[model samples]
Target: MRSLKKSLVHMLSVPLLLSLSCHSFADLTIDGKPAPHQNLSTHDVKELLADDDELELTPQGSTTASTTLRQSNGAPPAMHSGVVDTTFMNNAGPNVHAGSALVMDAQTGEVLFSKNSNSSRPMASITKLMTAVVTADAHLDMSQDITLEPIDFDGPKKASTKLRAGDKMNRAEVLLVALMKSENPAAAALARTYPGGKPAFIAAMNAKARELGMSSTHYFESTGLDPRNVSSARDLAILVTQAYKYGVIRQFSSTPHYDFNLGYRMLNASNTNALVRNGGWNINLSKTGFINEAGRCVVMHTTVNSRPAVVVLMGEPTTQARNTDATDLLNWLTGLPKDT
Candidate 1:
């Protein structure tokens, strides 16, 4: 009788233990703590999981879990949020071949595009722009004949020029050649003839840059052959915009070709900027620059999508690359909304 009673008690305890084990499975956590196990409707499930993490529902009616899981795991967010819009954010803008570049609205000074724009670099013949500006500000006798001297041919590059030692040309003609053709001797002669000579002319250039808020620009010499003649793309854009206000610079820099009687021969000088010579671009102001230190460079004031804009490109590997970069930027700007 005792054994049967013991056996019956053991059988009862076994079924009770099995029942507890089956019902005691782990509960899911909603907010870092265990939630009560219960039958949850779709709405209830959403409400429970909503505060815990961000969830995406699939077309199959299943919750896809947190999209921010990567963030929690120390991953950076995507470069662009949501669907990418090519109009506002162009992936190709950063791919421009120039080491430094900037595009700004000529009238409003609004920056539209930039890459290393503030980093100062050698500006090569773009120095002529400032040379032109300082010469213009002098208000000298543009018609007065100025003779080129040995000091004017002091650059290390030994570039060929139509003007020879003792070759006399009117100040206006000199200015035209200096700007349009990047004539080194003409620029040096302009600085040489300044009131206090080259030193005073360089000081005036710095002063003019300060006046125009080009803090990153500095000029060691009038001719950009000196590698120390440096400025940032941002600063060059400012210089170009200010220079565009001068009608002489606009006309001279944009002239495709100019014929001048040097008495010995009829010398013809063409604009250094190919875009200006191409006739397809409505270039208001243009300048091209190059040296071993500063690669192919260009600055221009042109209308893009009917908006006047200043573009500065520096340290491009090739002239063709620089032109293509400018064209790509122009097309990108044209595609953008007018408000941009």
Candidate 2:
């Protein structure tokens, strides 16, 4: 949220994102109708959670699921599906909390549990998931050298990378750092590097969303700081489903820290997601995001109930709420019979 300055030191051109910026936003549509502004029922949410497809942070900012977990102390509940148990999911412990959430089966793309999964909400930096993915797919030689131009600083929000005009970094190092640390400048730079500038990159992002079957999602910016970058939990699950499959994305997103040298300075990047430290959750793909508009958001891929799954929570009023929502769902997942 700093003032936008002129002169982008980075020499990259972003044709894609610039195009996206020009088009006026259309109201979201899903399943051939206007997107449901409200959340889905818990029952409908539960159905979506059982699917094996889960959110992948574009496999960027993505290390989808580390795997393996233990049983919860509670008795297993009867599941609604051939896979996970709905009754167990319905029975929430006192700690379960969030404004919106959905637990998804990573492999089958089923919903095992949900609260307000259909509502479109601001996503904050989780939009980086798509940013990371597009970078990987663009075939940019990540090892290629580039400088952070001042033009890269004009994102919807502040540039947290502390990059001033003329700072230099490689593609791979910046990509890894930006996704993990949630750097605004790096995201803008990544977008600007694409064809058609930032607008074209954003267009490509929405196009990619369409290709992946994300029925209710759109990206106006790469850093996710833009309030206009929004999606529902249901649509986000589809985003993660395609995101978790990338090897590089998976490695970088799950990493707790990365050290890179910018000339004489050593840049240390870390993730905001506390689940990385939970010890209980075998996190595969995870990203944490927040802004006043979005509250707090987290999307994770993990093995709960001994099966791969995705969990998406958005608009939790507090950081604690985000953690609570994810943890409670994990508890529900662990309590369900593995075969239920």
Candidate 3:
């Protein structure tokens, strides 16, 4: 099998992903105690593919689905809940390729558009965002140097990474590469060096999720290589919103590119989300993830129509599809009046 790095290179040349396979969900245990409500079965890719008929465009508080959106004087409601506002719905919205997608007002937590948004799916390296948050909240010394060990290369997928076993970087630099480049080894190293190690870091991730009201979210490790690390679009919207509050997260996640000095050589890393590199976007926070089981996924906090918005797109078949969906959503939102 080709390494993940090679596969990603090939993926960039191809227009679509031809096949996908499921990985058995890893068991969850924290400090030798089983974590509650963890699923152990393989979450098949076919299951993540929702039928077009099953698609529904609904708002946060709306009890009934409606295709008709009531526009008051050509402006959408600036903030609304429990009422239908098909601002990004069926024919009115973009042709989103993701199996599950959501757009929410960052400040109000109002879900403006949703498609299977509540369904849980593998989140891939988007897990690093949570890892970054947990690490930040711990208030660890950012200047402390961390050495990546051989075990950092060990993960469920065994994906190839640019970071070497002996690579030395400060805590802040490690977190930066993890979020910006979706570097699995960097993420693993962060958890491995955490207060009580990886297990404790996993616990903190889950605890933070609960505190932020992400009931549908769970974590098994820091790298997101574990298929069991799953979350819904709705749950991740809350995460994106909360993660944007952190200054370092906002800066590192959205940074277009950076050159990391490994003492022996330099490693050039770019943000996983393409939109962040584009001059057109005003992104505040961004994360992207992919594995065979999770497919292509992305979450972003950006400004749209002068209003802060959070977007979560998951289970996309290809990188092009994910980028297109994001572009379409952003453009759709931009067309809306600022008052909306």
Candidate 4:
């Protein structure tokens, strides 16, 4: 009986000793050295824990890098090194509902306003801006005719188009409709007719992005239907700045309306961006886009209070919200000094 009692005591003491040892060393670091917990006050410990939660730490307790002040669509912000205007966070700028946005001096490349500007997200038909850029770069015969094919109708969205498979239009007219109407088929036709076809055109789009220092941008196709065609607002600001150097993109994108002569009839289409037709605003370049994933997005290079600024808004829930943001931004810009 004493022998059995001694065995029970041994077992119980072993567990007690093991528990005490674990409790004693719980404050040790991975290297078996004592942690700096002795120097940490209760408030300091609380602050450290709070910071950990804010950083979106991994399972291994390492923090992920983020430039966005708020999360959008549960997407982590892509790494970017663009200049940011930290003052925008303190109500020093306009209030906007867009998930990501930026405003920059078109000529100086100075950022004036920024909100989640580095979060890469789907850009919708805004992809056509790059399409327009690539077409202009090739200097292809703008007068050459391109016949729409059945494959032109294919896209991730399978969007409807007025142009039929057999319809034909000169390259310039095709570009006009694509930029002004956000016509997916028109863009696809341009890609299909490129020197080496769609593959080459897509490559050119990505290459152009790289050349422009758009590290956070990527393109899988000319049309923005693919959610994979992503860019941050800051990168898009750079795109708009570069695109402004092209007269065709500026003219076609800003044109309020265009009438395409298809031999048999006139197809009238208006610019997708309403601000261009507003008359009160001086819009030099404009493009609007929408998709279930991208929400309502808009990019504009316009003069506000005699200051040329490029505005990029992404992931707005509604058109009204997007437009309201734009108008608010314009008003905010107008209130600033001219030199700003």
lDDT of 3 by residue, 1-340 (tens): 1243232222212211212222211122222232332121112212212111132312221112221222234343322222322234522778788878888666555566777776788999999999988887776766568899999999888886788889888776788889988999999999999999999999999999888767778999999999999988777877876676554576667766666767788787767788977747777679999999999999987776557778899999999999999999988877765544
What local distance difference test score does each model get? 0.68, 0.61, 0.69, 0.69
Show model 3 residue runs off by greater than 4 Å: 1-91
lDDT of 2 at 209: 81
- What's model 3's lDDT at 187? 96
Task: Rank the models by lDDT, top first.
Answer: 3, 4, 1, 2
What range of 10 consecutive residues in model 4 has the weakest lDDT sum?
16-25
Residue runs of model 2 more than 4 Å from their true location after superposition: 1-95
Per lDDT, the best of the predicted structures is: 3
What is the Å distance of residue 72 in model 3 from its true position? 12
Model 3 score (lDDT): 0.69
Which candidate model has the greater lDDT, 3 or 4?
3
